[model samples]
Target: MDRRDYLARLAGVAGVGLAGCVTLPGSRVTGDDLPSVRNATTSNTSSPRPDGRLPRRGEVTLPVSRREMRSPLTRDHIPAIVDPVFGDDWDGLSLPDDSRAESTTLPGDAPVIGLTDGDRARAYPLRILDWHEIVNDTFGGPIAVTYCVLCGSSVVVDRVVGGSTTTFGVSGYLWRSDLVLYDRATESLWSQLLATAINGPLTGTELTIRPSSLTTWGAWSAEHPETDVLLPPPQSNTIRGREATFDYFIPKYRRDSPSVIGFGTDSNGLHPRSLVLGVAHGDAARAYPFETIRREGVVDDDVGGLPVVVTVAPGNTLVAYERRVERQTLHFSADGPSRLSAGATRWQRSTGAGVSGPQATHDLTRANDHPPMFWLGWSGFYPETSVYGEDAN
Candidate 1:
């Protein structure tokens, strides 16, 4: 389906019932007609200043660019799905038996913790939730956390009240139940329409909040005018992207016999993440000659969005490497199937050449006689494969 159709599906999933409906203005255009629409030119001349500090908002990369990075694959090229797709379909997509241990979560909150405060939110995997999709959180707030799968741009939005938070998924939208601020003196999801206002100004029950039950689900699409909002299938931070301090890393394609996969993350968590995957050569400590792949701008909708051509870097290639907590481990297609152990620190070879690169699927469940799911986001080239998300298989 096209972006609009995909969005419509998401709206349906929001379960707006009769109250969530709203009349959309103007004739809706097909995905084909999007090309006719022109987008404004944006400048990327503002980089971090020489003071060794970060740049101002004008200096940072824009959200559109990050969208491009997340989808190096063309959206128009995506085959229309006759039926809705969920994250559970991937099975036997990775190495047979990986001996790798569980990767440790960062000290604070898990970087890609699932937001269980909603009906739909609770149904998807935490890793899949990492990708920013329009979901009605249990808090009754119709918000979206635009986390790119490749660039790792995570931006939370109230979509109504305009209340939002950057980097970390924070907003006026509570995680308990899907509710609007305007009706209950909190804030309306419509307030999120304030462009660039990631976080809105309002709090408590004294504020007014509305529900889709009030005006149908028109409030969601009305607020986000740029693109058709959709719900993402379950995925992982490894596939899409994840937020890190000042860094939004994204994974693209791999290089060299599908040995390594590429990834990039953004500092803004909403723009192109400058990362790639390739074979490691020259510098043992820091993988050198790392080939880069295009993560953003792969899609076609936004005109002035992601303009740079995705290519491999000139002198270096990236390599296949895994982080087992404090100790880092390197792997090769020759290393057999990479598997993860219970401890979450050691990766072992399956003694079988299963799938290699980021596309390889590893079964995470041992109950079904299937190995755990695992894939390296960093690889060396085209035709590279890696498994993404959790699966009982």
Candidate 2:
């Protein structure tokens, strides 16, 4: 079917008209209710896998199979920013002056993804990420900070390949609607949500994930007053043009939207846009949905065998910490909106440090691997993932 007929069958908008949006643990999407899978025959250009497939435009995809790869765009369609410049005031930065460019300042509620190492702390605004998916920087070390507009997943990982560091670019390929990136050094395809090279020489090698957080600008700024914010991409003067995204809050799961591509959701169940703190340890992965966290305020659970405590803070920011300190597991409860405690020791919700009592000096280690993500993206990657509040899992 062509685009119009395919779209017309899919609720005539962007997404399927299903009520439930989740899959049970260990379930695969083989139902007839799902949308038809498009045929993708992209070659692995630049660097062939030596196993026949070449990853170029409309050629073939590797190990992932051409059946699932969706090429709505070609490589580098949304250029990744390199040699990024940072400023102290996030609120002060403005989009490039253009009729199609963003004209407003960064929203106080806009979500940013970043990390604090020793004396340096930084936050990359999500609006900027909406335009450019990858930011290759030497912050702390060689790292690629990535966010998928469709998946709502922000991942930071060392960009070192074969003991040498390299930058990454958008491949314009979506593996199940997740961002597919390629290293400048190899042009090998990598999955943003899986954090693995799906094809090429380093195909099976895993990328080391750096700890990061996704929260609102107002909340992040208040916690780290000395934080530096990334400047918006310079306005394009040539064929390239700069554009602005007003919001990341997906209103509906349109087929055109990243969240709903090739999938179906229930009309009354959890929305595909529902955000969750995605946690993975080794091979085991789990999702702590925001809907459950907001109601309980604190979710004490284990993922990949690590004891995790997920809490909903002010501004709807979510923080996860390893509940065990000095080998002793602390049963945590919400002391207030943003504070958690175990007996007399109160933990700083912002930093995961104990603030009072005998073990005040000890700290609950923060889990940087947890990235706040939307359900459709997280569940698609880890169908065996056990949700926090779900009984079936």
Per-candidate clashes, comma-separated: 136, 24
Deviating ranges (above 4 Å) for candidate 1:
1-26, 29-58, 61-133, 138-345, 348-393
Which ranges in model 2 have alpha carbons more than 4 Å from their true place?
A: 1-62, 90-104, 235-268, 281-284
lDDT of 2 at 279: 74
250-275 per-residue lDDT for model 2 (tens digits): 21123234344563543324445668
TM-score of each: 0.22, 0.76
TM-score of 1: 0.22
User: Local distance difference test, per candidate?
Assistant: 0.23, 0.67
